[model samples]
Target: MTLLTPPGVYTPQADTALLAEALRDEAVPPGAQVLDVGTGTGALALAAARRGARVTAVDISWLAVLTARLNARLAGLPVRVVRGNLLAPVAGQAYDLILSNPPYVPARAATPPRHGAARAWDAGHDGRLFVRRICREAPRLLRPGGVLLLVHSALSGPEASLRELRSAGLKAAVAARGFIPFGPVLRARRAWLDAQGLIEETETTEELVVIRAERPV
Candidate 1:
């Protein structure tokens, strides 16, 4: 479970732990194809591989890719770590399960940072940039009966995710939820969040949700 997260690579935090817990609740048969998008340290990917799945981990950051590769190697897990935008590196690939803990924090910037550690969590204004994209693309990459388990802040609009996935012809719903105290990132943006009505004033906890979507057989 320990991973090497360098300066710019995202560290495994509460979201990672929650997603791993959700992964455990799924039945991943041996050699099932699994994709972990935005894999920072290959934590989720390795978790799936440990369940006897063939996992591929993808990240947009070079540091993240290298860190994930090293973690996989160190863990002796057979995870193929690649550096590319979400799902792009694995195009044309179909997976029985897809996992992601993407950037979902609403930020002041008009767009996500092109570089830096913030790229791991500083989503655009509404914080649904990556979430929406995943909802749109996951259905196509999933095999019939395939499942996608995605985790993000409740502040990012879970209803929108469910709606989008349903619109794409998948059965989607929140499978798990948890509350965690604000981390440094969220703590720093508390003022903005309150101003935007994303959170109540003086609120210190945020709800995280694991959205599970299945491609109907």
Candidate 2:
């Protein structure tokens, strides 16, 4: 689906597409309450809405929030678009599903960008900043039997995510996987990644993993 991704707003790409495919495979029934954390153009939120799930999309960027709200209005789909840090806007709410394609690329910076386009992709030195936070909060945000479908780079340590989710009392596993050639972001950071021993010197592609964690009934 086409979306209005203005400058500064993240455009849905491989990670978003991968997570959307994983969402489809889950076959969420109508009326399920779905929360989309770090929604960019509201692509995944709209995808869930199209499947008849009630969707609320959250983003930290004002441009992203506006773009997503506009896109949803244009599509005639109802989505509660809010601007805030991940999951904070929806505190005290529980969802049948929580979806996220947050910033996971390891960056030279010690912390993620507070503003600008890079905020959409650059995580801290070891990445996993948002990934780790989500794993910690997902248990509190999900309803019994609810699932969280999180997509991130293999370089971010999928095992760590699984371990965190499991430790939170949820059943977690890598639900899907795919590989994509380095994008400009990864390509630019290739040297740092190599020096940090996160990727092979000649590695041309990065594996993306979709982790599915469920709160037991």
Candidate 3:
């Protein structure tokens, strides 16, 4: 959850270190167009803006969009935050680089978060709800030879995500990985898996994979 937030929806559980670690060595010119999908707190978008990229951030929740914009202003960064589902509001707009941290949790048997930000944390039953959508639609929004970077839970099947991207005719690769404990809609899965003895309770990492795909000219 954001430290201080308005009385509305919010998506505050994204692992910002994922973006920072992935983008730690990146730089853009003053006018490069950049798109950040599922831009929860606008950290990546704001970072890109600082590097001189014209950033457009997108999120599903109105509160997230507002928070992103507010955060951008707080950082004195120039970014355009949009309130819409994945890729819906930014169609027909091609970008040189697209960044995303999609909701990869599956829609099945997931529990709601007692915490306020849980709404933004969980995906669908398979956790691929947003991942599948983003992989398919991302190529369309990327300019020829543009880059698309998506960070999500590998538990949703990283290979499947690659297939979706390749099906959309894009080349992809695994960029990075990290771990996050149980949160929001994905909470039930741990207990379910533990009951099935699929995972140990002491396991530390869940393989949060970042897949980077690109469209060729």
Candidate 4:
């Protein structure tokens, strides 16, 4: 089936489903102000809004932000989506739920990124740029006892990300985890390696991980 979003934005995909399902069971108080950091296809942001929370969805892509607003209206859910890089649009905003699904493919310059917009899906050389940043800064963005929901790769191993969050003075856990095929960067890099006669195409891809954390009261 064709996805329901404009180009430059990811249509609601499996990752979106994973995030929405996780939020559906959370206890974000009604009318609580919430911030959804990446807001791809308005998945997690819309889910929070559906639960009656006031939501501000932020994204660096103007098209993605527009698509998010369109999704909210289509869903009959009111949401405020802004164009800015990770919290840039929402300074001074404190949220009861600071959620994100950032590009965690590791920070690096890869094959000029096939899709300019798909950069949202590519994290960095180590797949830790946005993921690590999200966790490290989340404590300051959250209210006391407020919760944080972040999704990334378990392939990068949870310890580095978890330790980053803990060092930032937040309590965290692996709220959910699932498998996904290797991202574009990995696939591209592997192809390059093959071209150089490095590795075989038979190598297996890895899965992703989603984690959640809480700011102490």
> Tens digits of per-residue lDDT for model 1 on 1-217?
7788788888898899999999999999999999999998888999999989999989998888898889989998889998888988888899999999999999999799998878989889999999989999888999999999999999999999999999999999999999999988888888899999999997999999999999999
TM-scores of the models, in the order given: 0.98, 0.98, 0.83, 0.85
lDDT of 2 by residue, 1-102 (tens): 879988898888889889999998996999999999999999999999999999999999888999999999999999999999998899999999999999
Best by lDDT: 2
Worst 10 residues of 4 by lDDT: 105-114
**TM-score, cand. 3:** 0.83
What is the lDDT ranking, best to worst? 2, 1, 3, 4
Candidate closest to the true structure, highest TM-score: 2
Ranking by TM-score: 2, 1, 4, 3
lDDT of each: 0.92, 0.94, 0.75, 0.74
Candidate 2: global Cα-lDDT? 0.94
Query: Compared with the true structure, what per-residue lDDT tens digits does model 3 show for residues 12-45?
Result: 4445567556765545568989999988778788
Cα RMSD of predicted structure 4 = 3.5
| Number of residue pairs clashing in candidate 4, backbone atoms closer than 3 angstroms, sequence gap of 3 or more or interchain | 12
RMSD of 3: 3.5
The runs of at least 3 residues in candidate 2 whose Cα sits more than 4 Å from the true structure, single-residue gaps closed, are none
What's the true lDDT of residue 144 in model 4?
A: 92
Candidate 4 lDDT by residue in tens digits, 1-217: 1225777787665566666667876898889988999887787888788789999999887778888888888888899998887876777768898878887654346422545765776665566667766776777778898888777666455778888888888888888777766656567777654554433577655555667788889
Q: What is the lDDT of residue 96 in candidate 1?
A: 99
